[model samples]
Target: MTTILEAKHVNKSYTVHQHEEHQILKDINLLLKQGEFVTIMGPSGSGKSTLLYNISGMDQVSEGSVYFAGEKISALSEKKLSKLRLNKMGFIFQHSHLLKNLNLLDNVLLSAYLAKNSSKEVIGARALRLMKQMGVDGLASHNITQASGGQLQRISICRALINNPDILFGDEPTGALNSSTTAEIMDILHDINAAGTTILLVTHDVRVAARSQRVLFMLDGKLVAERNMGKYNKQQNIRAREAALSDWLTEQGF
Candidate 1:
């Protein structure tokens, strides 16, 4: 598989009170392949989330570089990087962050409208299709407060896909949902990946990481280890996969 994103000897730090350096990511290297589903897992303050933001260009690196689709994103100007992200990347977070004023469907169409690459008729039709694909078409006209957590996340996913991003970056996307709801969301994500979106997620849940094709373990601002668990499908024994991953994570001091 071709490399969709790569971090070469990356390092990141911040200046604390009185010029003290707070190092977050340290000499890390990583990659996400085309059409792959990868997750980063670690304890609190392990730099997993920081790494995600840096590699995706949501934040800049203090040292080294990040490449996305062969472009050196770390070196791009803010304007160019914003344009690149708007055109090629999608993001989801622990919170849905949907606007309070817009209807669900309109919320999903907000970014597409900003991009202004298509007619309203075309974008609206695609919005409805994406909402339906996420099983949220019934709530298209409804306010965000009217839906469950899972439904809101689905709407967020629809919004993320609106511009047909080359890669989807998720930061603990299923963190706020219950187990059953999380499972449902994971199923939706798997189907999306099968349809060809490269996904790189940061998560702590073993069950969530188990569904991914590869899992990267981070510790103390470093990429410590990884596992290639293979493709996921309905017929496979998920519990067994989870158990095996759990054991391996334990070995990683997870």
Candidate 2:
């Protein structure tokens, strides 16, 4: 696989109050290869979401740079960054973020429409195909309010795929779903990754993290440990992973 996403010495900080600073990400580094699925696991307030936001160009970093397909996204103007995000990356959030006024198909196609590079006809066809793969094809015309939470979530995934992004960044994609629905979403994500799309998922769920080929364990806004899941069975790997995590937490006296 080729390198698709790379971040070097990335740092981000937030201003909490007058002359007070909160360091959310501290000299972070990351590299993602094509067709690889990597999950980031961290406790609350550990900067998992902040890392995702910075890497995905949703927010500017305080320092360092992120390279996507040989382009430095950190240097792009806001307009160009928006284009890069819309055309090259797919995002699935905890909430589906679908428009209430539009049906499933319309919601998906609307992204392409706003991006200004793809045709509605092409986007609509691709969106339908993705929804069909997710088993939500029968509800293409249904509004989000009319759909079940699981259906809406699947539709969000389909929307993300409509543009055939170079990478998929999911921030707790399964966080709001029941176990069964979460499992379904996980299976879908696995299938999508198997089909050669690079994926970066930030999740607190152990089961979700175990599904990835690599797990990056973060603490206090830093990547303190990493586990290669390719070396062990899923159950054993998760147990070991959790054990290591426990050790880290215990060391911190938490």
Candidate 3:
């Protein structure tokens, strides 16, 4: 498969009081292939979330570089990077973070409208299509307060895909959901990946990692280990896949 994203010797750090340097990510190198569904798993404070931000250009790297579509994104100007994110990348945080001022449909169309790459009619149609596919079209006219957590999350996913991003970066996208709701969101993600959008996510949930094609284990700001669990198939034995990943995660001391 083609390489959609790459991180070469990526490092991230911050300065605190008295100029003390605290490092969060260390010599992290990664490659995400086109159309691949991958996840990063680690304990809290292991820098998994930090890595996601740096690799996706949401945060600047202290050292090394990140590339998207063969361009060195870490070196790009913030203005260019923001434009790139708006055009080619999508993001989902732990919270929906939707704008309460705007109704659901308008919220989904917000970034696309900012891109101004298409007419309102075209973007509106695509936003509605994505909302319908995610099963939240009926909530379009409603404010965010009118929806459940799961419904809001689906709307967030629609918002993320509004511009047809090449890859979706998720930071624990299902962390706020109940068990059944998590399953439903994962199913939606599976369908989205099957439809050819690459997904890279960070999660503490074994079930979520089990559904991915590969899992990368992070520890103490390092890429400790990775396992190719193979592609997820709804027709396959999911429990068995989860068991296999659980055992591997155990060996990693996760």
Candidate 4:
């Protein structure tokens, strides 16, 4: 498989008052293969999100390097990095983070408009297709307040896929949803991964992690364990996978 992203000896630290350093992420190494679905799980303050940010180039590593598409992204300038993120990567946060003033369709089209790699007509068509695939096409002109939490998240997924990104980075994407809604979102994400968009997600829910092909456990800023669950199939027994993962996580002291 092709390596789409790689982190080498990555470390991140923050300087508190009086120049005292607070190390957040320890020496981390990881590689994300193309079209793989991977999840990261850990207790709060375990630096799970920090590792996601560093590898996605949303935050700079204090030491070591990150590479995307075989290029050293950690060494790139902010402008170039921003462009790379816009064109090559996609992000879905816990919150929808939609603009209150814009309707759902416009919000989905926002990033594609900024990217400018294609005409408005082309991008709009693609955005509409994604919204349809996500089952939010009917809510196109609706205000943000009018949609349910699940619908808003589906809209956000539409926005993330508007650029046809090589990889999707999700930070607790379903964290705000109810169990049923989380399952729905996970189904959509599973379909997306099956359709060949690489996904890296940070999640605490074992149900969510079970849908992924691999799960990495973090502890005190270090990756302590990983479980390869293999490809997810709707026809298979999901509860068994979740139970197995729960057992392994227990072994890892999670």
Count of clashes, each model: 0, 0, 0, 0
The TM-score that candidate 1 achieves is 0.98
Q: Candidate 4 lDDT, tens digit per residue, 142-227? A: 99999999999999999888999999999999999999999999999999999999999999999999999999999999887889
Q: Estimate candidate 3's RMSD in Å.
A: 0.7
Which lDDT tens digits does candidate 1 get at residues 92-138?
99999999999999999999998888999999999999998889999
Model 4 bad stretches (over 4 Å): none
| Candidate 3 Cα outliers beyond 4 Å, as residue runs | none
Q: In terms of TM-score, how similar is model 3 to the real structure?
A: 0.99
TM-score for each prediction?
Answer: 0.98, 0.91, 0.99, 0.99
Q: Which 10 consecutive positions of candidate 3 have the poorest summed lDDT?
A: 10-19
Task: Please give the lDDT score for candidate 1.
Answer: 0.94
| Candidate 2 regions with alpha-carbon error over 4 angstroms | 231-254
lDDT of 1 at 66: 93
User: Candidate 3 lDDT, tens digit per residue, 9-47?
Assistant: 999998999699999999999999999999999999999
lDDT of 1 at 46: 96
What is candidate 4's CA lDDT for residue 143? 91
**Candidate 3: which pairs clash?**
none
